[model samples]
Target chain A: MAERVRVRSMMPPGHVRTPAYLRGKVGEIERSLGAFPNPEELAYRQKATARPLYRVRFTMAEVWGAEAENPDDTLDAEIFAHWLIPLDD
Target chain B: MPHDHHDHDDFHHDGMSPSGHPYRADNDTPLTYWQVMEIAIRELLIDKGIATASEIAVQIDTMDARSPADGASVVARAWTDPDFKGRLLQDASAAARELGFDIGALRLIAVENTADIHNVVVCTLCSCYPRNLLGLPPDWYKTRAYRSRVVKEPRRVLAEFGLTLPLSTRVRVHDSTADMRYIVLPARPAGTESLSEEQLAALVTRDSMIGTGLPKSPA
Candidate 1:
């Protein structure tokens, strides 16, 4: 079964992979892109630990609300595992 | 006063100032602060013996040698060969290697445009492009407007580029990252079955590969 997830609303001050617009939004995991070094830590020249990266899919409506021209259109973004929360439904 | 006017005459028309130093036009030739930082870092790295200047020059030369033509050839081959398309869709980096493109550590993903779905790629954080296959990205790809708005309004963005898709067609925007890059394999245009691979490649534009526009029909 496909996993449904929501982007965390946390806003930390440094390099981050999650875009601000996507914060607190819901999306589905398309696929696992395997583990990659955490770029957030890498930016500070710190040793980066590998984290699972997943490609998340979101409908235009989910992102832009009623302003979307095509609600059915989808956008995919690669988000690190640490940035996503698995939903209970 | 005559000597001062004579000194002005001594200034070369080819961007040299009256002081006999090379001068860059304020409007046309100033490097951005980021560019200046890049130069400083590169020189510092070389001075520290971390990397040689010649190695940097060779890397730049290799990047300069790549163009849209390389990507066009890949698309053309995919259009003509079903097996090759399968491989390309399954493992883009490997398939690109088969065509002699040495994509570095970053994974390359090939998204196909179909009758029902069209794909577009963007890098919201930074401009992460498939330079190994398509050379440097256009300036517009690195703009703030494009990075912020393309995912939100892909159809409208495509329209601004003179590419209007039917309402029934779905637009999928792929956000690229430092770890992965994406390229769109545009659908083959109609009435080009008789054309050779070389001729078909000529129809593929850089924008089409980027998914902002479509390939031109044969004229």
Candidate 2:
């Protein structure tokens, strides 16, 4: 079974790799991109820890509700593991 | 290479630029805060003996030398060689390096444009692009309108570029939110089976690789 995840909707300020549009949206894991330096910490000149990243795919409808030009079309974005919350369902 | 010499030079179009937007005098414009910060950091790096002035010039030259031709050649080869295509799909950066392209640290994902699926690349936060592979992005690609509209209405945004997909065709938009960059491996145009590898490359336009348009028909 494919793993489903939801982007954390936290509103903390400062350098964030997670886009505002993708926050709180549910998507499926498209693929794991291996571990990379956490950009959020790297932006602040801090000793960044490596974090696993995944390409998450969300349907247009899931992102834009009924306003989606084509509900079936999809959007993919690289999200750090920390920004994603594993959904029990 | 004079110290006071402004960076703007050459390439004058009439009123409207090729992308249907007016050309901006951005090179001669006053430096923004970020630009000033960049100069400060670079000067500090140079002063600290971490890098040299000539090294920066050479780096700029190297980046300027990378053009769509390099990517077009990759696409052309992929269209012809199944083995290379497989490698390209598997690991785009490695595949590009295999072709003698020095794409340093660019984690690229090459999405294929099948008959029923179309792929587009954008950066919502900023203009993160596959610069090492395709050279500098067009001015439009860096604009707020493009960055915002692309992820929202990709089809409509593509239509402005004069590309219209069939009703059955699905569009996939890739937003470069982090380290990874993306490039579309545009499907080869039909009737090019007889064309040479070089000839096939000529059809791969910048927009085609960016997924805003399709490869040009044989001319």
TM-score quality measure for candidate 1: 0.88
| Tens-digit lDDT track of model 1 for B156-179 | 888999989999999999998548
All candidates' lDDT scores?
0.90, 0.93
TM-score, chain A, candidate 1: 0.96
Docking class for model 2 is high
**i-RMS, every candidate?**
1.2, 0.6
Candidate 2 lDDT, tens digit per residue, B1-219? 653343322223355554567776668778999999999999999999999999999999999999999999999999999999999999999999999999999999999999999999999999999999999999999999999999999999999999988769999999999989999999999899899999999999999999999999998
Q: Looking at model 1 chain B, report the run of 10 residues with the lowest lDDT sum.
A: B6-15
Candidate 2 wrong stretches, greater than 4 Å: B1-31
**What does each candidate score in C-alpha RMSD?**
5.5, 6.2
How far out, in Å, is residue B164 in model 2? 1.0
